[model samples]
Target chain A: MAHADMDTQRLDLPEPMPQPRFQAGFITPYAFIFPALLVMLGGLLYPVFMAMYLSLYDWQIGLDLEDAPFVGLTNFSRMLTDPQVWEVLWVTMRFGFWTITIEMTLGVALALLLEKPIRGASVFRTIFILPLMVSPVVVGLIWRYLFDARVGWINYYLGAWFGIEPQIWLGDAQLAFFAIVFTDIWQWTPFIFIIVIAGLQALPSEVVEASTIDGANWWQQVFLVKLPMIKSILVIALLMRLIDVFRGMEVMLIMTGGGPGRSTELLSLHIYNRAFETQQLGYASAISVLLIVIVFAISTLILTMANPMKSRSDV
Target chain B: MTGLFKKGVGALAALTMSTTLAFANPYEKYEGTTIVVSWPALSHFIKAEELIEEFTEETGIEVEVDALQYLKLRDRQLLEMSKDEGEYDVVSWVVMWKGEYVSKGLLTPLSQFYTNGSLVDPNYDINDIADAYLQNGGIVGGHKGYMPGKSGAMYGVPFGAETSILAYRKDIFEEQGLEVPETYDELRDVMAKLHAAGIPALTSRGKTGHQVTAGWLLHLAPLGGKIFDDNWNPVINSPEAVEAAQVMREVVKTGPAGIPTFGFGEAAAAFLQGEAAMHLDTLKIAAMSRDPKLSKIDGKVGYALHPVGSRCGSETGGFAAGIPANSQNKEAAFLFLQYITSKAGDQRMVELGGDPVRISTLQNNTEGFDEYPVVAEQLPCADPDWRPLIPEWNELNIDVLGQALTQVITTDDPIQPIMDAANEKARAIMEREGYYVWQ
Candidate 1:
């Protein structure tokens, strides 16, 4: 009898209202998006296409594009065996690994520690993000001076406090690499903090309440519920940082100039040195193409692990 | 009385007309034309900037100066010159680029302008410029398309030609009873003595790339090392070259606390601050050493010709002014070029803290030529081929030899192996660039 009553109630409900439809023809939506599509094509796609085209020629810096010899795949073949190319790539990978690993760990740890409402919480958050506000070039200069062997405050303080001897920070190969890695981490850790904190704060309240009611401990709740929910955000932050690591090198360029014999020369800096320092534009373009491929592959792999485009249940 | 007054008025009017005709501005025809100049932000160019207003007032041609950092100046000029319509009417280039610019046809030959009497001032004596600066900066189109030669076409006018000189502390030398070193062995002994007496003996540029290569070249030529032979083969691994590298390594040992990372500015500062006893680099350092505001030991600095090794060869390199081939205001640009490099302009350039390229200016400018004696003595020894002027030189200098030098100075590695490695890479690049085609 209850089932029959439920069925009769469903049947008696008012007919569903018809969905609204656009009165204009199909051209309306296309017209609305045309400007954005044009921007993407011109601003984003054009340079990438030009790089690909130029990579096929043996073009030097001063020559006209028409006069450039059409040496198909010669630049690419050269890149495959160029020892400097491999060395810089190896350096970039090592740099990316250390910086990203530490940044992710520290960023998440700090976010979780300060995610709650507390005394001066906003002030702490602002202070934590200050390094992100500084320009990379300015950061490089500041760190370079601080790391100077003779006049730097770092040497001064070490001597004053502990009587440690002053070291040539940028002159040594290992130290230069360490200095650059430390600088990158100092500048970029805040980005991950911002993203991860936002994701942590946006979790639905009821789920946490249910978990608490089930007698979950703080550690259990964080590990099993909060972290699982914010996995996608963490992946995205990691991907962004990885991309930045490959693209940005101004700090290293200004600090060490990829020196102490290219110990800190990342792939981007290598491409820059090859392009401007050596005046081999076509060879540099080939290296850039390789960089773009590597970045694209890494992004694709990360996105597959945590697809943000998936529906909520799927996520 | 009326007739006498009329005759006086007629005479005065005729005198006024003749004076006005005699003093007419030669550049008045190009009035209202605005030409842009691209220059490096070196001390010389910035000092020369003070005279731009004077140039404009005289020529009635407005001038816009684009003073860029030394490293960025070439990139900016290359970009401008590559365009069909260039923005820079006048451009300044360093010695290393003279070959590339002329070979690429980016510069207009000054010979044509000089021969065309209408474009050149009749009083402009091209021969008055020093042969070292003129041959290095002006001549191109020889061996490998850019080597300095007498038979080559004249492309640019030398403006800031510089040669290296050895600077030492007069007071310190007198206190120690030291004689000015004239040879490499003497230099080493004197430097070791100074170092043992608790004074850093030398300050020089070693901060990789061109900085390191430039200082090494100071020793390279004097120590009997040449980058290449007559056949364009890299001889950097030769016995004399290895000796040069070893000598540089020893010099770095007795240099300032952080000598390996010092650029020109830092090296200059070390000497000015009295942290070091000697500097063997550009003659411009002499001017800086005498500036009371810049130096702590201003009148205490002494100048000498570069120390001799197997032979005496001083560095000859600096800037030159050129007109871009695509410049829209070629005549105006040439006029600007001529005005700044003339006898009076060269003197004024020295007064305003710029290096002089003219022989007469160095001799005649008593008020500004403080280092005139030593520089004049050093001029004849200036070697135009101090470093190779080929386009491939950038790679050889920066990527191979420069990086190898950075390695050599920073590490205690075997010098021969590092130089040999650099030699192999240089050979490879030259082979690829067709420098070995004759072989």
Candidate 2:
């Protein structure tokens, strides 16, 4: 066999063919991953870099490229002085705070209330989650028509069924803020509810049974045992809501158009208005940059509170 | 494994295909090919796109339509011109950016088109166009502005024009023992009566910026405040202007419940559905308010000028179209703009929601005009101030006016602060643009 193999060597050199730098393992893995890395860098990282770069320049979107006068941090400084910017930010924060707080409270309550498989609980759960499925714009439009002072179904009832003054739901600043907050809570509470309910269901029966054996009441069980166990899930849910809160201006833009006085003007809507309507592209970009920072900082805080990586590894 | 790889590649390819961004048309060929013109979110552009097939048959040119928002369109215009790149052959510039659009080195001069007597399609008369529109408005960016086009250096000729007229519910007016308010005082009295009757008198502005600026502020401020001085310092936010804004606030109080929250579309809907007793807008909405297809109160609408204060007249708010300096099809775009601006185009629009400025259109009694006496006389009666050329106007209107208007309309806060802020901003913007900027 050795003699036959030696004969079959043909024209082999004494040093033999040098092995490739990497056998299939290292090279093959990178070959598999390179396209993905390229995509991440190109799509996500590039835009972020561009947005940050643009934030520094006094740039208009459609103006001459040569015309972007670099104003250093003046755009950012102007934003700090701009009352409208701060007002819009305040509106956004209030909107986010109300929507998330109410949503979280109601969501947990509903999930706990319905966790027990009672008659028609499934149907009720299905109905509860339905509003979340509808598009935000559709939701806004529906609410808009419903809230119309003259023609809305809401006003019709106020006029006919009850002797209530027709509230300008989308007009007066306070009412408009409440209207947006209520609309958001109505749509998003189900998301929290669904997550919490799932977390409740996943709890070990032994833990529950042990709690029952200890003569702990239902309220105590929920607050003490169940809530502590599902804190991480709750945190995740809150984090998601926080992300959405930053981007919550679309519904307001459609419903109220950021009007009756910048009452409903959230940061996002303000940025959009400045960018498109005003053509102050540089100012708009700076605001957009601020918005990104705000959203990122808030999101980071929320995520760190949950620390899913830390919590999940232990679990 | 091969199939998986192929599927991944295909998915990536599809993603790339879907997002192929619009690029400059390098080809300057103007064969029997059709090109499209567009306006910011109006129905005319939609119809224009639909008619491309017919145009293709007659002219053998391929055309398409693009309907963008007003701000988006303006941005597109500046960008396309800066690159001197043409992607479209026609554009809709109704009553838009002022004559300085010609002076700013942005547009191609149509003086040659005018001299050649090919200014319009033969079926359309060149004489019928309002003289002011031709003389004053036709200038832009240091050139004698040509009519609006899809691409080229020329600005767009109006495909349509809009001047706000009072739209009132006839039933409510009759029941309230009121005639259409012809003057500001009468409008006030009539609106108060309507308010007493528990009917919303108007559908005021909230969502959109220009809606209130044009429909409300421009209307009242011109009547009360000094409109255009000998020196073109716009003092529309003067004490008189404040009085007018206050009047608007008071008047808007009687409008639909969410009036301050309403944009044009909502306001129109509210009026058409008999929610608002009156709406102040152009004849363009006359068709919509009359169309049984959409309007609930079709033919139940009436018209009059928005109540004038001390002044004898009204200001105009109209869109304009222009070609980008970089258009690949300059000649074709120019032809398209001229064609659309001519009588034939106006008449065609007359059948649709066209607000014709041609004398012939008003004289001929277009379809809806014969039904209403005011329509017959209205087109010619409109005041012309598509006004003195202002360069910094883009910033003035969009940044200064729009911002203040939004602040006022949306929040019921101090109008003074917003107005003052706007005035300051407007001054800065105007000064930046090298206009006569007063502190």
Candidate 3:
């Protein structure tokens, strides 16, 4: 009778709910993620892989894909040896250095100054981001017109306000480079400002109070407590801005066309001119691969050094 | 019995209608077939768009026009041709694109249409087009693909024909006591005088790439500089080329402050605003410079032949229309091409302040032609091959020569090294394209 009772209890236990099959659970998670994974593979990975494959061939614009001759590593080696590539890369580096340095400095300084809840701060913030909202192409066109020696409003304003002579803003190599950099600063500084301001506002109030209780001054509180707390955000912003500098070409394309002797020809613009203007699709693809590797390396190095999420766990 | 009789009558009427439809118009078979025509957004294209309705009404074929920027048009045409079938039946291209288009087999040879009497209108006289314009634009590699007349297969018909000309401010020149310069030396003297007199002189395209190169070629070609020699050796760094560069430098120095960055539009704007004393550009600008609505210096501008250097002519540059080889509606496209470039079309173009490639239209001696006589005179002297007529010429002219010219104008660098470097680069490009014989 006891054995019969034990069997009845086992039957009443509902078969342990079928053990919640591991395979089904595992597949459910993946099935939920499958569509996005497919999108990533199609949009990003496929193009990257295709570009890599194209880098091995000597392809011209008008030729059929099959007709393009396979010339493995020739384009890569040629790019490495090419002086124009070095020049363009140097220009890109210099542009990135100047633009990023100015933007970060101005951005962080503005963020620190305007972090307090002041009257009309929202209006000022809106005004600051106006340039950011304008299209890059439109920005380029606007700057081009303003920099025109004969008819530009910039020259007119300078002459009228400062009693300065009209300047050739986009003619000389140096001036054209300066013009593009200035335009970039005007357009991108607000992006950093908005990011850094958000970071500043999100700082823990307790940490700030503790710093204040320890007799930390305004500079000390900002440099030591506030900045360190938001180091990850700054690093991420820097990384994004760096990527932008490498990727940007439209503004320069419209303004200078990498001209006055390629003084403003960024690496990306050089790749574009090589592919479309010169019809060296294979070589351009190879250059693009090199660009991607450079960007990837820089990004990985930044993430490793800063690790934005690392501070979250520590806090 | 009455139903049978009525059915027979209906059948006979249907047969008669079908016969009438077959013999109605040459393009009747292609009726209701919509064809897309792509060209750059220029005045002539606008004129074509205005007249496209007439074409549709006459043939019952539908036409859609896509007016894009010059570079965009080229890219679109190239992308379409690279496919098995193209979206554009009629493709309008710059004269410089002829060699590339032919070499890539992007254009259909129009000889078949010419031979087929029913396809072409009897009144569409190919001989009406100027010989220089016809040869420079229509014929490529001994094949005529577009316009009828002359040898080779017609690949394209001349749409808006243009050659470089010297446009000077008559009022400014008169006030400054300057005559139209005939030689490079005289041009320099005139520019110097104008500069000393506190007047800007000689606005030309100085922006790098095709703009600067086209401007430079105006001087380079007349200075007896050849882009290449008989064996395809680049002679762009020759003494004449250096002289041409020097001349360009002197001229640019006397012009606007941002001369190195000035494109065709900017240069023209400066001259038309009466700020510059002289402008060297296409003949099409002559009309624009005289237009009361656009130009501030209307009636103050005078046209002349481009200043003579070692030679006495100007570089030819213009747009042409061709039927794409991959066009699904080649017959309809050809009809459109012929209709636009015909005598009536050319007349319409001229009336709309656009340049005409037809000799009869140009010689009309009417109000438009009377206003700009230099175009007709300069047409005879236009150098068809002012730039190299090769598939690689765009890179050589714009990327190589354009860069070299930019350096020449912008820097104090010795012109010879720049020219030599450009030549070397051009030669390398040619060799890569199998233009040179390998030992």
Best by DockQ: 3
Worst 10 residues of 3 chain B by lDDT: B142-151
- Show where candidate 1 strays beyond 4 Å: A1-29, A209-215, A311-315, B1-25, B291-293, B366-369
Task: Please tell me which model should have the higher lDDT, number 2 or number 3.
Answer: 3
Where does model 3 exceed 4 Å of error? A1-20, A23-25, B1-30, B143-152
Using all chains and alpha carbons, the TM-scores for the candidates as numbered come to 0.92, 0.83, 0.92
Q: Write down the DockQ of candidate 2.
A: 0.27
Instruction: Give a tens-digit lDDT track for model 1, residues A185-228.
Output: 88999999999999989989899889999999989988999988
**Cα lDDT of model 3 by residue, B1-439, tens digit:** 9999999999999999998878767887788999998888986677667678888888788999888988777777888887888788998888878778888888898888898887888888998787767777778865223222354566888888778888888888887778899888889999999899888888889998878887888888888887887667989889998888888888778886788888888888888888788888788777787677769987777778887887787877788788888999998888888887888978877776677887778678556454346777777778876777676876787778888999989878898899999999998988877887753
lDDT of 1: 0.87
Tens-digit per-residue lDDT, A1-315, candidate 2: 888777778536366778999886878888989999999999978877776677677776555646777878888888898877888888888888898999999999999999998999999999999999999999999998888776778878987889788887876668778888889999999999999999999999899999999999999999999998888898889888887887667788788787656777888888888776655677787887888888789778867777866776766
lDDT of 2 by residue, B125-201 (tens): 65676543443344344321322334323344545555555667777888878888777777778778888888878
Better of 1 and 2 by DockQ: 1
Tell me the DockQ of each model, to 2 decimals.
0.55, 0.27, 0.61
